[model samples]
Target: MARTLVIDAHPDATSLCAALVDRYAAGAREAGAEVEVIVLRDLAFDVHLRRGLRADQPLEPDLVRAQGALIAADHVVVVAPVWWGSVPALLKGFLDRTLERGWAYRYRSNGLPQGLLAGRSARVIVTTDSPGWWLRGLMGDSAVRQLTRSTLRFCGLKPVRATRIGVVHGSTPERRESWLRKVSDLGRSDARRTPDAGKAMPAPREIASDAAV
Candidate 1:
């Protein structure tokens, strides 16, 4: 069975992002995948990388378990909220502190990066109050690019997919439900594919649009 890890990067468990994580995990489990979740708010760990890879900083117990989960997963799903055209500080801190140099990636002899977390796929879901045009045209999809290209892909998670749900501030309850269903469907679809199968899947430039907002 495929193993999937869902990372809830929202600071508040009552946020919409958390609901999305729950729905996605439920869908994956329903599709027969073994699902694991890492709720950043619940984990006890220092978010700061004080040494900046220059010195050794021991991993906290929760972070150690998180790394183990990442190592065992075939797919990784990150659910976060966009703030100031980027992900929350908590999520950024998690990335900085968790995806370390020797574990997630290492420098090649030629000074290039060799991502060790190869053979895995990823999906990023971000919620924002901004309209699709503003987030894409003005913000240049900063949060999406950071998670999908700069981080996950840099660590060798291929075929990274992204979904944006937005204008959330005044969105109707029905619209929220629609977004939840879409995310759930995405989870089910992703769970059906094995790691190798994911390599063959053509990633959509944008899985869902907030143009309707």
Candidate 2:
């Protein structure tokens, strides 16, 4: 059976981003896949990596469980908002604290780090007030790219897929519901099976919101 873990990084419990995560989890469960959700806001762990590669910081209980979930998951879905052109501090901190050395990666003979977590796939869902096209053309998609590349890939998760929903500042309730449906569909599709490693990484898809409404 497929095992999927959904990480919700929104601080507000009632935010639309959290709702999206719920819908995704529901769909995955419907598909008979085991689903787990990690809400960062609810966790009591410190959101800062004070030591930075020193591996001196001790992970909290919540972070320890999260790390185990990540290792056991066949697929990982990260849901977060893009703030100031990057991920929120809460999610970034969770990554820094949990993805520790000797756990996620270790240096190889060439002095380059080799990833320890392999054979899993990841999907990144990001919400933003700015349009995805603008981020791609002007801002270079910094947040999503960084997570998928420098972070996830660095830890050995391959073929990472990303979905960007944006211009949310003025979206109508109906439009927001439609976005949720799209996320549910994504969840269902992933639940059916693990990602095929042989397939090429598709270009990031965009969902334009009624932000100007």
Estimate TM-scores for all models.
0.90, 0.89
Top lDDT prediction, candidate number: 1
Candidate 1 clashes: the total is 0
Q: Mark the regions of model 2 whose C-alpha exceeds 4 Å error after superposition.
A: 195-213
Off by over 4 Å in 1: 196-213
CA lDDT, every model vs. true structure: 0.87, 0.84
> Each candidate's root-mean-square deviation in Å?
9.9, 10.3
Residue pairs with backbone overlap in model 2: none
TM-score of 1: 0.90
lDDT tens digits, residue span 78-133, model 2: 99998888998989889888888878888898999898778888899999899867
